[model samples]
Target: MALVAFSAVIPLMTVVNYSVQDIFGPGQRYFIGVDWFREALRDPEVHGAFLRQLAFSGIVLAIEIPLGVAVALLLPKAGWKSSLAIVILALPLLIPFNVVGTIWQVYARPEIGFLGRVLNDIGIDFNYTGDAVSAWATIVLMDVWHWTPLVALLAFAGLRSIPDAYYQAARIDGAGRLAVFRFIELPKMKSVLTIAVLLRFMDSFMIYTEPFVVTGGGPGSATTFLSIRLVNMAVGQFDLGPAAAFSLMYFLVILLISYVFYTILQRASAS
Candidate 1:
């Protein structure tokens, strides 16, 4: 608890302090109440970034969850093959985020990268650096490639934990593959899926490094999510006061949504 307070709570309080105060330098500060918060709430850039962040998170969850579940279902149940499958699936999750970004950066360059060269050769004007649609698609693709493995692994665990007796009963009752999955498998994986959604949503919402390295929050702020916007404000603009306020609101939004998800999961588990 003490360590947590020192590591987490102390920095948080410092942010809270900066949020309400206008500080130009050491010994150059003044309390401004909620002025910065009010301005941030009205800021168009913040609103745009918030919407983009939501869209990214939504797209990720949509792509990852079902795909992961399907892959998990298809993975071998028991064998040397199952072990090989698990190892292969876990490879992407093992790569560091910055490294993933750098890899995509090189892999999408039109002059040299295989993907870029192939697309241009096929007469598709695919340039993530110069085009908004391409940027969004590449970022989404990169994120999906890297993180879907985590969902697969989680769903794999949930799938593996189901007792064989359930499948036996389903078979005896003439339950088809679809029926078994819909009624038996899905219900059993609900808790695991809920956790997966929460984790993915939170991670995707706060994603910065990958997109930053890939696009530098561009093709004209098209890929600038909340985290990028916050960094731009805090570091680039050097507006600590407004940046702190934005950070606080960001934290609150995350906390509120997390609580809502937890409550829903609890209610679901109960009945």
Candidate 2:
């Protein structure tokens, strides 16, 4: 109880306090009601960040969920090979977020990084730092590389949980691969896939460290998602009241969307 309060509750309360008041300096503050919230809602920068965040999260979920499932399906079902594959797939998830960013940053360098050098040599005109499209692509690819393993591992667990009886039944029915997957595998994997989708959505929605380290929200604000924008407001500009309000709204958005996802998935599973 005390630990939760100190770590989460207290900080949240502090943000709530700051959200309604204008702080000028030490001990110089005044209550401003909902002015900051209204301003945040009206801010074009916030709007852009919000939209970008949505797009990024949507893209990530679309790519990772399907790709992860395919990878899980393709994995060897057993033996030493299965163990080795699992270990290899788990490697990316074990890497620290900032370290992943740094690695990609160097690895995508046009002159020295292997990826960048190959692309440039192939005449793709790729430069993550100098091009907005390339920047977005790099960030998305980086995210996919770093996080897809999680979804794959989850789906793999879901796959492994199916009983031999189910496969035997499918075989007796003379079911095609697609029919078996649709009728048996997918239905069986729903619970874990639901978890994978929710986890990926929430994490991608709140992502900051890796993208920030890689792009710094550069190339003319092309990748300035909500987290980056909020940090810029609070830390860069020292707009505590507005930043606090923004953060509250941010929290609410995540909560609301996650609830919607859970409800939809629950209803689907039930049906």
Candidate 3:
């Protein structure tokens, strides 16, 4: 409790304090009530970033969840081969976030990077730094590469938990592969899948580092999601009051959507 208070609660209170004040350096601040919040609500940059964030998170979930499950299904059931595959899948996740960004940034370079050079050579005109669509695609692909292993591992654990008796029963009943998966595996993996979805949604929604490093939140404001917008306001522009207000709103948005996700998934699982 003390650690939580010191780590989260105290900093949160400080943000709360800043959110309502118009600060002019140390000891020159004035109370401004809800002015900053009103400004944040009215900001068009905030609106665009929010929409982009939703789209990114939605696309990520749509791709990674199904792909991860598919990968888990394809993995060797039990062997040294399975161990090797697991280690290989997990390697991407072990890389630091900033390093992941740096790697992709270099890897997507138009002149030098293998992916970029190959695409251009094929006459595809794929420059992530110059094109909005390409930038979005790269960010999404980068996230999938970095994080899908996590989902695959979770699904694999769920798969391993199913009893041999269940498989034997399905086999004796002459259930086909698809039917076994649909009736038994899907139901059994529901809880873990729920967790996977929530984790992916939250992480993807708040993503900043990779996109920032790769696209720097643009060719324009094209790749600018909410987190990037917040950072620009807080650090780039140094608008402390509005930034603080925006941060609080950001926290609420994530918390609210997460609760909604959890509740819906729980009800679906229960039914």
Candidate 4:
């Protein structure tokens, strides 16, 4: 346990150290204190990106959780077909992230892309490159297409773990499908659902590559989330001090939210 902790603690300590000091050149450095953190907190763009990230995360959770549960409930409970379904469901997750972005980028183009052509033909006027609504829709739908499988897989595992005795008892009590799901399946799946929610929240909050590749954070700055904005500041503008500070703050936000999620779930389960 000490060895495991040492491995984790060493890296985190390095980030915290960098977050406070200014690296000017090679060995030329100065302790600038919390100036970077202060600046990051004051940046209007940072505030915008943070709020945008929160909204995106909320949208993802809202769509993915219920959709995943429904998909899991619809899936067969047993047999070779169920095994095949599991394999098929996992195929999308196995693909690389950048590749997923590129696939969607082309797929949503109004000219040569299948999705685009269909939408245009149907008079929907969809174009991710030019339209903010389309850009947002594409991002959300891409996320759903890429990630809903993860939720479904987790929820399916949760459903399968439930004892047959519980179902039998529900049947004997004259409970219908909805009651069995609400009182039995949902309660049993709470722990796994919590895990899924946290995982999705963290991933969505930190997402950069897909949106960056697909939209380049625009036709304008419509899709620039905190991570993308941080990268732009650090690499694009060469503002290392502020970038380091922003990165540390970013880590803390994720850590705090994850802690809150764990605490709430634990209390709910205990009660």
Candidate 5:
């Protein structure tokens, strides 16, 4: 209540105020209703950043979800090996997001870095700092390595929750591994997978720090997702009105997408 109001509602009202005003100083401001939004909506560079954000989220979900599910499926059922596997798989998630980016940044340097040197040794020109394609690949790979463990851990929990009776029934039916996965495991995993998708989608959509730290949203503006663009506008350029409007629009987009996912999740659960 009070906490929410102070933290979220108050700040939002301030943004709404800023969105409708051109502010220069503490007391220097003028009302310009809806103008900032119009400018933000019409900006070509903003559109490009939004599209890049969507693409990044799409790629992350495509790779991480399937890889996570497969890894979860292959994990040991029990015993010391299972415990060790869990520990190892969870290691990446333990690293701070910023530090993860720094680690990858160092590892991807074309000179002394292991990944960079291996690629160059193999006659491949891989330079994340200076090449757009390499930059994109490195960032995407970094995200996959960092976040896929989260998805896998969630899926593993879902898999572990199923009753032994279900497996026994599948065995009695002579169900093959694929058939068991599709008919039994898949359906049970659906709820958790839906959650994984939503979490990944929202997080990836707002992704900034790692990519910024690694490539600084560069090799040009090639990796500048919406968050990076928003930061550049709000903080870098000091455009309060436009930045406020953009932030509101950004909040709406996330809300809308999450709502859509929630609708689908509910319907799936109902069916």
Candidate 6:
């Protein structure tokens, strides 16, 4: 715990220090004090990026949660095939983030890419580079493809942990499929699902690598998420002070939402 705290604190403290100080050079520094925070908060691009990030995360959860649960429900209870199924499902996740982006970037090229070629052959003019809608669809589809298995695996573990006695009781009560899911499977899966939701939210909210490599935040900033924007500010533009401040604020927002999710899930479970 002490080691973890020290590691986290050290970097955060360094960023905090940079957030206030203007570095003209190695020796030349000026204490600006919250100027970065003000500028970052007032930036319109920041606001647009944040809204885009929030909406994307929400949409992903809406799709992935139900889709994951459905996939989990379909898995066999016990067999060699179950293990095979799990390994196959998990294959997408084994790919590195940057590699996934590169794969998709090449795959989505309208002229040379296999996917784009098929779509064009089928009479659909699929051009992610020129179309904002196509770009958004590509990013969202890539994220869903990459991450839904994670949610499914977690949900499957939750389902496997559920006692057979619950299903026996449900059968005795003549419970319908929906009722069984609602009252038994879902309730049992609540803890794991909460964890899944929090994990997905945090990951999606901070998504940068895949989209960066695929879109380069192009099609006119359609896929420029918060993390991408922060990188552009801090690294691309070399605006450390505002970038640091924006990052801290971004971290706080994530922390607050995670806390709220935890509290609400706990309360729901308690009630």
For residue 139, model 3's alpha carbon misses the true position, in angstroms, by 0.6
Model 4 per-residue lDDT at 5: 68
lDDT per residue (tens digit) for residues 1-271 in model 1: 9999999999999999999999888999999999999988898999999999999999999999999999999999999999999999999898999999999998988888888889899999999999999899889999999999899999999999999999999999999999999999999999899999999988998999999999999999999999999999999999888999999999999999999999989987999
Off by over 4 Å in 3: 265-271
Residue 59 error, candidate 2, Å: 0.7
Q: Estimate each model's TM-score.
A: 0.97, 0.97, 0.96, 0.94, 0.97, 0.95
What is the lDDT for 157 in model 5?
Answer: 95
Kindly list the per-residue Cα lDDT of model 4 for residues 1-271, writing each as its tens digit: 8887689887777777777888878798888899889998999989989998999999999999999999999999999989999999988899899999999999999999899889999999898899988998999999999999999999999999999999999999999999999999999999999999999999999999999989988768788899999999989998877888899889989999999999988987898
Give each prediction's root-mean-square deviation over alpha carbons.
1.0, 1.2, 1.3, 2.0, 1.0, 1.6
All models: lDDT?
Answer: 0.94, 0.94, 0.95, 0.92, 0.94, 0.93
Candidate 2 C-alpha error for residue 91, in Å:
0.1
* lDDT by residue for model 6 (136-245), tens: 88888889999999999999999999989999999999999999999999988998899899999999999999999999997899889999999999999999999999
State model 1's lDDT: 0.94
lDDT, residue 25, model 4: 81
Instruction: Estimate the TM-score for candidate 4.
Output: 0.94
Error of 4 at 153 (Å): 0.7
Q: Encode model 2's per-residue lDDT on 67-113: one tens digit a residue.
A: 99999999999999999999999999999999999999999989999
Alpha-carbon RMSD, candidate 5: 1.0
Please give the distance, in angstroms, between residue 97's alpha carbon in candidate 2 and its true position after superposition. 0.3
Clashes of each: 0, 0, 0, 0, 0, 0
Give the distance in Å from residue 144's predicted Cα in candidate 2 to where it truly belongs: 0.7
The superposed Cα distance between candidate 5 and the true structure at residue 193, in angstroms, equals 0.1
Please write out the lDDT profile of model 5 over residues 123-191, one tens digit for every residue: 999999899989998999999999999999999999999999999999999999999999999999999
Model 4, runs deviating above 4 Å: 1-14
- Cα lDDT over the full model 3: 0.95
Clashing pairs in 4: none
